[model samples]
Target: MGIHIIKMPDLGEGIAEVEVVEWRVKPGDTVKEDQVLADVMTDKATVEIPSPVNGTVIALGGEIGESLAVGAELIRLEVAGSGNQNGKTATPATATATAGTTLPGSPVSTVCERAEELEEAPAPVAKAAPAQAPLLKAAPPRARGLAAPAVRQRALELGIALEFLEGSGPEGRITHADLDAQLLRRVKVAPSGPKPSDPTDAERTIAVTGMRRKIAQKMQEAKRRIPHFTYVEEVDVTELEALRAHLNGQHGNQRGRITLLPLLMRAIVLSLKQFPQANARFNDESGIVTQYDAVHIGVATQTAAGLMVPVVRNAHKHDLWSSALEVARLAEAARAGKAVRDELSGSTITITSLGALGGIVTTPVINHPEVAIIGVNKMVERPMIRDGAIVARKMMNLSSSFDHRVIDGMVAAQFVQTIRAYLETPATLFID
Candidate 1:
């Protein structure tokens, strides 16, 4: 019998420390090799630390929200095997499993490398600092009404004045659904709202911590450091919609139902082939821009755990049906907070949509380091002029933001125009 110490492996380039968000196993719990032990959040994504050998957990490194340096002792295990006595930790197989049971909507991947791997890895090449503080909107007062602690916390974060909120939980306790309803109601507005006022006597103050804090920091950094230029354009999707319905009808029950996103994604990938500048990343520190051959599209999805963007890798390689299925799979996993870390990173370009709720003209901020982000707006049926005649057609808007330092105005306009052309003519997507 021997004891093995599992240290936090190098999470990624330049990430020297991480926060322990959750622990899966406790002392005296017997765990198997490759089983998840803890969830650690890094700058990029949340990663799952898997146990290296089958053993009984004797101790944990830290509590939730505790930050630990990489290579620090994470877990102490008593094993019933040999070859681990030399202080060498075994690496899991190349097949890494995703654990969504802990935090849904967040990617969780097993750490499969050894300490030496961390040493051999090169330092992170580029660093982008936050340009300014995040501009947060006002949240509502604390509900003096009956509600669970979790419900109350969510209400405060969303700035919902919950004093008048109706409760659906047992004994009139407030529920998560109720809070969501309040949030959606507030989101539907004619213009951007004002900043939230200071807490009132009726409001309960909730501390900003965990993932919420991280999101605020990143957004601020991107907005302040990068000079953003937004361009908005409208596209006619009547034929595209018809073709989508026809394709879905043909697919029948053989595959997942197709959504407008995959069609839009296919169009974007084809457009990137013509304008690669939009599909690249810029390093502010080095003043260098790196273009990628592979198209990894980040789909910004809203979930119960704030907003999470999961990447659809090698998107250009998949067909319409396959792209639809991949989008659905990645979205579902993200919604459930079960996406893996790899699924959340390495997006050269991003596409954000509100689905049916997509409104008109959103100037989405560019995900830092990445040069561009494409926004999808709500599709509306309106009167149009065609063939010297007025008729009703389904129309939508494509709103995009670019890093002005990397992409010029002409290039950005041309890039979006190309996407407009592909979407206007649905058949063009099928061709090489």
Candidate 2:
């Protein structure tokens, strides 16, 4: 019956204008309310903006790789209900159930208010005017990869220009690794940080773009907006390792590569069964804590593109092998860039791992809404003193970070300990 304007919502901190990476709908296409219509690339994350109003698309603001400010008119829509009078636009205050389905609005974006605060403050003076001279090539928005904001700022500090370099990231954004490789050309050793190079001076350029960039933004919002606390415990995965090996040997690599992941996941699910209080999300605006009945554990995998936390949706629905199968499928899809839109989001809880790169311990960011994250590290063969004798054992560290506003310190510690019990005993996972 009438047309409506959907403005771009702010993505996150320090995010200015985002480049329209791709538009999902064209003019005259009917879209459902809350259906994703475009992918916007910020300095931090690739945001999928949904249609707020169910209607027919009338016009898209721009084509791919075009930048638009937050609050800009992104899409015009023609709704199905309400009468138009005097040739003016009109829409039903109440949605028509027959035409389209609208999901409840997701938690008030934690980043929106923060972005408003930043905008209301004083503006900075112009640093310098653009160069009129020619010959310097500028890389289009698509050329760079997934470096974090910190990494990009570091690159700028080192006097490295982003436009010249080739990106090894998803959608071709420059990454910290690409920068490190350049630095490697100059120095024998690489320094350390998120951007490689430890206690050294050689530097290079890194551009932040795509999902990994988004991961950084979400983590920041989680850290700032949500009150979080950590609870850590040393888990003896010795028995769990034997069980995993036996299962893998029986199934072999083709059927599925049995690893501690499924065992840990199974244990995590069972513990959630016991302690339902731990399985919850904090609603910041409503001042309520929402607990979930299903276990949708998000596994945090780091690909060459960036860190992706794909959910094993309804993880509790599957058996041990089925759980393994689902985990493998999601992980493989993520690494291959075959992950569907929904496959990457809507997690109730999460687990993050650094594979062989993980050290003795590291605190991971709590995936927002999910309230908690389980972090896994490298298995080290170390000397263990038991029964008055020292013996070598392969052991790994598990660290869990929780939103303190929802879960208290003691409950979190106990939750990890409960999971440790199943992992340490191993048979507890199989026993009814």
Candidate 3:
């Protein structure tokens, strides 16, 4: 018998550390290769780490709910027929992972899955209520997912139909919310729950550890150190939206949904080319400005944990459609907590958009050292005087926050105007 020490694998690039969100297997528990050992929290992702070598766990290096740095020893296992049970033997890392595997008990994946299920489910419209009755009744027993005694009792108390809400929790169990919603819909409830707890006075305990700390540190540094100047431009996106609709019609649906952000990315790249000074880093080492030609645009995506920025390398090369797809893919991966270190690191500039939650204008903090950030707001149809006549046009605000130390206000304004022009006129997007 031999025991192998399992140090935490590097979750991804730029991610020097991670928090132990959960430990799936305890000491003395047998784990198979590729079986999940724990869920870890990183700056860019919340990942499920699998076992590199299979064995019975002997000792783990962390306390439950403590944060452990990446590459820290996480587990020690006793494998049959190796060396000493004292865990002096090295682990056998024979398998390599090309794609990320989901970890068990991840709340982020569960939330995403729930959102998709709701979206795919037939919308609960009052008009279609009668027509969908037969389908809802014929729904399979597997959909019910209540086969256990405790779950049955809870389901009955909530007045939940054993069927309707699908079980997503471990072993397909119906949960509290599922039952509550069903009960509420069937019967009315008198206001209970301690006569409405005062929200302003309520305090909840949250463990301030992991990426939350890192984010706080970064934001504090940015606000304290950098002198920021913001410039705004309202661009008419009617032409761009028209071009997008035309492209989607020609190339089919999957290839054509041109998100506003991609168009914004292209505009930023064009402006970056024109104003190369904006794509620069404030080198603390040399105390000088270092400029680069390659534009690495980081798209800020919000996850269940917090906000993470994942980079899209060389945004200049992608057109409207390709850039849209790339941003979408990166944002999805970022939200899923699957983004690696490299994806979250080395961003020259950042662009943040709230999708439909977008409002007209927002001030973005300079992603320190990078010199600039752009915030894209939602597009809305508004009346504008174009060519001496009032007409409705699709318009959105483009906001840029720049480091005033490196970029002058005039230069920042020009750069923002240039991007607005490129977006307002789609032909300039592909032009040299």
The CA lDDT at 361 in model 1 is: 78
The reply for model 1, stretches above 4 Å from the true place, is 1-5, 25-35, 51-60, 75-200
Encode model 1's per-residue lDDT on 175-259: one tens digit a residue.
5556655655665543557645655523333433446656765686788789999999999999999998888788847976788
lDDT of 1 at 143: 43
Residues 142-200 of candidate 2: C-alpha lDDT, one tens digit per residue: 64434556558647766677777776443555655566555655565555656645658
Residue 196's lDDT within candidate 2 is 41
TM-score of each: 0.67, 0.58, 0.68
Error in Å for residue 98 of model 2:
44
lDDT of 2 at 140: 66
Where does candidate 3 stray beyond 4 Å? 9-16, 46-48, 69-71, 82-202
| CA-lDDT, candidates in order | 0.79, 0.73, 0.74
